[model samples]
Target: MLIDKPLPELRRYRGRNPRPADFTRYWREALRELDATPVQPELVPNREIDVPGVECFDLWFTGVGGARVYAKYLRPKAPIGRRHPAVLQFHGYSGNSGDWLGKVPYVAAGFCVAALDCRGQGGRSTDAGAVQGNTLNGHIIRGLDDPDDRKLLFRSLYLDTVQLARVVMSRPEVNPDRLGAMGASQGGGLTLACAALEPRIRRAAPVYPFLCDYQRVWEMDLAKDAYAELRDYFRRFDPCHEREADVFRKLGYIDCQHLAPMIKGEILMYTGLMDQICPPSTQFAAYNHIRARKEMVLYPDFGHEWLPGEADRTLRFMLPLAR
Candidate 1:
């Protein structure tokens, strides 16, 4: 189906974000009813690992429960260093840290980078001269029919996100206070959650983040994973739209928007105006509720292709603080 629909009301507030709330109102409520859960960490410290110009180690941490999450600790070689600012990196939906294997701009810029592997997604860690660590990684779009299921599903994604981040910050060579988060698409959504849920996060840079306004985005657009799950859900049970909505209501309980407000830090969110995959209105819903220092870069023509000069622009905004 074509991707165009009358979205819920998204209006601007006086000297603030849109107050004329819509779907976010209900979604945020459910997230609150379910208290923020702590992410558990299982350190795989100092295992000999190799990347490009930098050396790295693998850190395996459990998500909400036994959900094994992976992260790569990348660092520029420095024989003498006690503390350095760290950047917790996340990959897009269905991507892994290896996708960023060659991007040494961050570490070369003098920041410790920990690119986290989204649990259940395809691919495994195969660093040079390092033992391979492979396991059953679940897809995020699975088990969308209910919250108890999502708490188990998303909890792994969310916790692996923060726990690896926590490990990055706790490193003897990194400053825990100067920690920040960045990602695109689904990773962007996880970035929002990590910054909010992890108190150690001082700043965030999310580009074309998915998972902001969940119910609303799912309603207007139909894509893959998150959106496809909903579409198939309705397809299988056409009898009860109410049942699907109920499931969504429960899922919203753990969404990033509800968690964004709790994060007190600087935020830089990049959004595409015509993005069908992640409707702009959904981005605003979360952007507005942020009670932190923030800004948005809205692209008029961009759909989701890493915006022209967006990588540099995003880093420019972040450098004022992160550097």
Candidate 2:
């Protein structure tokens, strides 16, 4: 409620960002390109961390634009021929996959966990830098000036998630039918993208997701922190606001709200009503468009930070996948 619309109004808000006229065709072509690219997955054993009842590895795969993507993979030791459930964990903006110990809780429950390190961020993943545009500030506007919309950095990042999911699902010990995805902030947005592009994901939990309703964030004047790149992009490139609508329309291809309708997995979204970083209305914009079975948990007084007990709630929400 802090600067956003009231809770009731937020629930009814669809979004203000424009969806590209070729949205579906655009994504279909992206998927086809991903399909053509060889995953070339490699899992190198991590000999440093010794956790009882679990095996760990540094997973690497080739993503679109030939960038080498990385992820932390952990699987519970199980009887031969037994396949277990798996979860894909994406990290926040500018963060790498977290410590291996953080993923043990899922492994302890007879599940496999793969934490992705988004390309070009604070991780081992390599950025191909193939796009033609201002790469000065953030990935959100990485390819804004390119004639080809597919050059957008986020387009590649979103495909990386799907490719990772496919590699994880191909593992002999993982049950493809029981895969789930979760993350917060930028990671949360990726979770939605992964689920939308790979419909086989059984469940998805996105916590106060970023990369949603860009125009809404700009209009609300809440684009300063995590979304600061928006302001920087305008100041450096289109200071006169002449290309505002065009810029936002191009961004629509990467917006989570536009992808929400394509998600087939059951979704459990978390939102902090008082959040200013990713305002409540912006979060609701994506949440409201989800056509899948879904639920939203709101914190009346919380901001964009931690939501007490969210970890436990997410664990319980995803527990059904193990069965």
Q: Report every candidate's CA lDDT.
A: 0.65, 0.93
The residue ranges of model 2 lying beyond 4 angstroms of the native Cα positions read: 130-136
TM-scores of the models, in the given order? 0.78, 0.97
lDDT of 1 by residue, 134-228 (tens): 43333433455444443435645665566677667767888788888888988789899888767678889998777765567565654354456
Worst 10 residues of 1 by lDDT: 13-22
Q: Relative to the unseen true structure, what is the C-alpha lDDT of residue 248 in candidate 1, on a scale of 0 to 100? A: 59
Q: Flag clash pairs in model 1.
A: 31-253, 120-137, 120-138
| TM-score of model 2 vs. true structure | 0.97
lDDT of 2 by residue, 215-321 (tens): 99999887798899999999999999999999999999999999999999999999988888998888999999999999999889898899999999999999999
* Clash number for each model: 3, 0
